[model samples]
Target: MTILNGLKILDFCSLLPGPLATMMFADLGAEVIHIESNRRVDLMRIMPPYDEEKESYIHQHLNRSKKSLQLNLKSEEGIEIVKKLVKDYDIIIEGFRPGVMKRLGIDYDTLREINPRLIYCAITGYGQTGPYATRPGHDNNYLSVGGVLNHSRLKDKKPVAMGIQIADIAGGTMHAAIGILAAALHREKSGEGKFIDVSMTDAMFAMNALYGTQYLGSGRPPQPEEEILNGGTFYDYYRTKDGRYFSVGSLEPQFRKLLCEALEIPELIDSTFNDSSYTQQRFKEAVTDAFCTKTFDQWLEIFNEDFHGCVEPVLTFDEACNHPQIQARNMLVDVKKSDGSTQRQIGTALKISGVEPTYQYVGAKMGAHTEEILKTYGYNQKEIEKLKANGVLI
Candidate 1:
């Protein structure tokens, strides 16, 4: 059985973070009912990484293993239908801005009246409370406000956007999922529901915890490209012989010695180069020269012979899929499509002993389960037809 086999989740979220969070739950076997809008499909349906036969990879990845029901929350009858479902669900996740859900009359307070045991998680860019809570912002704005951008800026260069939506995924969606899980467990013991207010900005601040701690303690500001982990030649990326790259994190003396020995650089044997100024110049040049002498394959071979934990070859998406270590860890899984085709998909990163994770369905079509959901909510055939005709359900 899946971990969340008996749990019912009402996923009233969209975009990346909230959907991905609840998708993870659905993947683990939760009965997640994705409450979409008949007025508009989720933006991901038309976004990038689309497949010719199916929807975009964003929709495929985030909506897999769940059921969808398109219902317009703007209509009175539609809100009533959602209220009925709330009575049966254990958790509800909404990613709308603050006051939007309440305006629809399906907010936590209204639902708590029907089912006090429900765990309601509200995920937003700045949270439900704060001066910027009402402001419309995206992942970029959240990261900027939460000080995450400071860590990502290049030396003397403007801060660049990250490859992934760290604020959305890491901060908002992930924390909302965790909060819901925690609230669910607590409700099991307390017989009371709870509200989880997750802010993307607040969540992103966690990325700078260690630096924040040091900054607070030493009265030193966290400068761009200067922190030990963020900067320093010992723990950074370097281009290799073929213009490909590898990363080294030989922060400790022993690991640094291993790196120097592997590259046959005796000049870096002393601690003088350990200084920030000297290390940034001499160590980077030395490492760059050594890497330039050999191809990425040759460097990989050298690292394979050594047992140090500080060195690793940087991998592209394709390379990462076929990497021996990743393959051994079962990080990638082959998913069979309905048309007798297959695609390589990422598997769950969590590895719990004695508990296997499973995904039994691909992403379904929009509003694929509208009739079924209405029936489950006690709506008869004729009543559902009326709602469908009125544009409440499609």
Candidate 2:
């Protein structure tokens, strides 16, 4: 059986973080029902690069293996429908700003009265009670305030905007999933559920473990390009003759010696441990010049010959998607859609023996399963039609 078989989830989340967190559970065979609204469908459903017969690529990718129920939660009948479903769901994840759920009278305190065993997870920007908790913010703003953007700069340039949503995905999505799993385990033991307050900004601070630890112990904040791992030394990216970049991470003394020997620059071995900025700059320039003399492919061949140093080429997106290692590990799979077509999507990273998780299907259309879901809640056809006529079910 699948790992999450028989588990039920009600997802009142939209956008990236909360949807992604619940999608993980759905991937593991949990029955996830997304509470959507026809009047306010998820923005991802309309994002660009849509298939001719399906929703946007973002929705198809992130909402796979989950069902959708379009119900206007603002309506009293809609809220009542959710309360009835809460009694049977094991978890509920919501991404609304603080107090929104409470305003609708469906917050954790209200839902727990219906089902004390329900695990309610709230993902907010700041938190449920912080001064900036109610303030609206996005991934970049959260990263900026959490001290991540400060150290993520070059020698003199400002912090670069990341292509990936680090604060949203890594901070909110991952931490919320972890909290839900931990709470579920706790319920298994104590026979009681708990509320989880996941703050994206607070979670992003944990990513500063190394630099934060150093500053806390020594009271000296890390400057950009002042540490070995943070572009401070020769252990950084270099441009090849083809203008492609290669990553060199020879941090250990032995690995550094190996890289220096491989480059035929044995004199630079002593400078590896030097902390002087001027010396490090000269060392980095020397390595850059050396790497530029060879094409990326040539250097890759040389590194593969005998070097055990952590030196490799920086691959492009297409290269990475079709890389031999990724293919061997089955990191990508084809997900079927309702239109009898398939899309390539990334597969689960977890690889448990005898429990292989497979992609079932892409996201369904809005309200695709509303009637089916309501039937499970004991709503007959007449009741469902009456609710629809009253502008409750979409």
Give the clash total for candidate 1: 0
Residue-by-residue lDDT tens digits, candidate 1, 68-122: 8898889999898888888887699988889999989999998899999989999
Segments of candidate 1 deviating more than 4 angstroms = 272-276, 305-307, 336-342
Q: Write the per-residue lDDT of candidate 2 for residues 5-47, one digit (tens) a residue.
A: 8778999999999999888888888889999996877888888
**Clashing residue pairs, candidate 1?**
none
TM-score of each: 0.94, 0.96
In angstroms, give how far residue 4 of model 1 lies from its true place.
1.6
Off by over 4 Å in 2: 305-307
Model-by-model lDDT, in order? Answer: 0.82, 0.88
Please report the TM-score between candidate 2 and the true structure: 0.96
True-vs-predicted CA distance for residue 318, candidate 2, Å: 0.8
RMSD of each: 1.9, 1.5
